[model samples]
Target chain A: MTADVQTLASESGCHLFSGCGFPSPGLNVFEFKPIFSIGAFDFTKPMLLALISMLLVIGFFWSAFAKPKMVPRGAQNVGELGYLFVRDNISRETIGKKGDPYVPFLFSIFFFVWVMNVMAIIPFAQFPATSRIAFPASIVGIVWVTYLVLGIKNQGFVGYFKNMMFPPGLPKAIYFLLAPIELLQGLITRPFTMAVRLFANMFAGHMLIVTFSVGAWYLLGFHIGALYSATSFIVVVVLTAFELMIQALQAYIITLLAASYISTSLEAEH
Target chain B: MDGAAWSSVGYLLSGMLIYGGIGWLIDRWTGHSALFLPIGLVVGIALALVLVFVRHGRSS
Candidate 1:
């Protein structure tokens, strides 16, 4: 019940890398140690979690898709549905006809995030890698590079900047202000916002579960505590369901944004 | 419960702002998102380092 969330909150930070504690030495007592780091490469617990998530997602789907059947069943159906869902909703809709070539890339991003988010509320392994900003930022960075390079590759230097800077339908008089705003937004805000969106959601979600779970534990002590404790039990139950919904929503959002980038590029410049 | 007792919200918020701020700066300069990959790792570690020093600095 409260065990998994607790494990994640406690274990994630300190198991590897070293850091400071909260509430002081004998009080708040929370510190995370660095697992290992070089220049910018730190292998921490969450890093391991991220690796496992990628491996698990790829391995399971690979097995499922490895042997196709006339009529898909069990894991194969589940895996295929996951892939098809991204293909139809995200790739097809956002990028439209031109986005077909990117189906595999879109599918990987969607399903990978989908599975990582699913890990959070699954009882024993109640952890979400995206809760670590580094994790989501990495993916966002990758996606940003892909579209950015493509935008430049296809449109060329001045053309790519022009396309991103000035979208199709804008007042000519305002292109000066709007162009810088657009360029800046793409360069600075877009990927960070993308990473933070997923990171903030998962980070907040897991923390809520942990806080309330701990609150419930402490509450079981007496009359008020017990009453609040029992109430929290119910709250956790309801929140868990909502959290699952948010998990899927986050994955969809990431995939949708990726496809939208492609679609925007394909449109004729204004 | 692992290290300190600060509000989780405070730590997370600070992390978000600092990491985002630093990442933004790197993006502006390098024009490469890869610049952030290592930077985040550094900032997170640096944050931890600061935490270790801040409390210890006060304690002594």
Candidate 2:
């Protein structure tokens, strides 16, 4: 059954988008010229989609929260829910007592990311903005820079450098090897991984859905293996439910991790 | 032989595990939990492209 489904995906042509003879899993179908480039930076189709999604999200909530009703109605409620979710659930949970001050910043990150991921599920406009590495990486770079700048800004350069280098409560022998290694990690690896997490998950998830969707279409072609084809129908249904859960979970995870990073940095102890 | 093929498969998975181990080390060092995937995909892909298109193929 699995073998047959695999064969279906390989041959299926749903005409969703031109994938440049590459296995795009049918996500990026539209082609557009680059808008502008600053030095090495080239803005492409994905960036445009992200911008539009940002506008749409802002517009939706602006209209929602423009007037504060006595009893919260429509957009205000939704916006408030978003703010409360990240502020209370994520920031407080991660950062504990000191979370209130950082609530606004974390709320912005969480919503922007969640909205970008939700863009994929939006009908007619089916693009996951965060799937584009540039968008997520840019956000990650921002967060990484925030932590570095804030850490140094709050704790003087020497103090922050020392804080990162010799994390409190490490064995004495380990410091010899750990300091340079820790510095290297702080300087390089932190931001790199943060950006990649959102990029990989959304990228892979979208591809998988497209692959299966196209496979389902492909299987409807043959008569003899109709029973197995029916399973594709079932599989799609199951995967959709799983994908919805995962989509939200991934956004929560990204924000949760970000808050936790901030929380740990705020702590003097490890 | 078939044993060599199976051994190579084992080696590949183990390599991924080891790579992940190193990544976890970086995460622990930096106090940032999620940090490896972006480095691997975005920066790593760019590095590969530079290596291929701009670096190796170019001359001093």
Candidate 3:
């Protein structure tokens, strides 16, 4: 049987007093059966959701900006608001004047991530694609390449490593102890932590929602358990609302970090 | 700045991982269970703090 609580609930007809133990949701909930297979590839639910999110982002922008009025109305107006939000709050705040060129990149990342995260709250598509590590890892991979390339391009190859590993004004002797730390932090830890931060937040959020939802379902029955079920249901609702805010905040945070990384690459500090 | 603050965290964590890892290797090489691991961790944290101070502490 699928790990989905609703499916298990209907199939087993188990309730709090039914003598069967609670079918608590676990890590199994995150795993999905292949919707289809093509040679070596197995297309799953999260993959399908991520694909939809990308198309949604692309389609929205296309319609919004396809026929631009001198003064925007309808979708164009909303599109301008989204674009300006990223430009002003994220890109400009982080990268200044040079940030304008990168606004589209940050804008796309922000909205695509936001939509993927919001999928958690979306009925029937309750899983956030980002809760899966592969999605965030892929995004971080792009960011990793972008900053590394930009750093090398702006500072030259040797100069980039020099700036990253050997900050000026430090005593020569200390560099021996500190250079490796800097290298590790810059080259590996930064991107690793970025992906972990987004993935962990979504993963934990999804787990919490699933656990409470299953608890509620299992507790529902003709007994005192019904009241407990009501309480659990309330918690489920509250956590979902909290997840909504977290989804948007995570999107903003990742975008802001991306912009700052790009900015640091553009100009090396002494 | 938020970026500066967040990167400081990265610095601290990398410091621990790099040194802790080195310490672990030393332990395996020397046939001791936990001698250098703690020493490495302490040194790592100290260096990380110093790095944070140098980079973000004194903003002219």
Best of the candidates, TM-score: 3
Q: What digit string (tens of lDDT, one per residue) describes model 3 on residues B1-60? A: 777877898998999999988999999999999999988988999999988988888885
Candidate 3, Cα interface RMSD: 0.9
TM-score of each: 0.70, 0.69, 0.96
Which window of ten consecutive residues has the lowest lDDT sum in model 3 chain A? Answer: A1-10
lDDT of each: 0.66, 0.62, 0.90
Candidate DockQ values, in order, are 0.02, 0.03, 0.82
Error of 2 at A163 (Å): 1.2
Worst 10 residues of 2 chain A by lDDT: A14-23
Query: Top lDDT: which candidate number?
Result: 3
Candidate 1, A73: how far from true, in Å?
2.6
| Best-matching candidate per DockQ | 3
Q: Model 3 residue B17 lDDT?
A: 94
lDDT of 3 at A194: 86
Over A3-33, each residue of candidate 3 has an lDDT whose tens digit, in order, gives 3677768867888878898887777789888
Per-residue lDDT over A1-270 for candidate 2, one digit per residue giving the tens place of the 0 to 100 score: 222234344564422233323233443333335778878877865687778867877787788778879799777888888888888888877678687888877776777787788766565445577888878888877777777777777777888888766755546785564455455445555455557777888877666665665555555544644555577668766766676777687678767766765764675434
Q: Compute the interface RMSD for candidate 2.
A: 16.6
Model 1: lDDT to the true structure:
0.66
On the 0 to 100 scale, the lDDT of residue A33 in model 3 is 86
Candidate 2 segments whose C-alpha is farther than 4 A from its true place: A1-44, B1-60
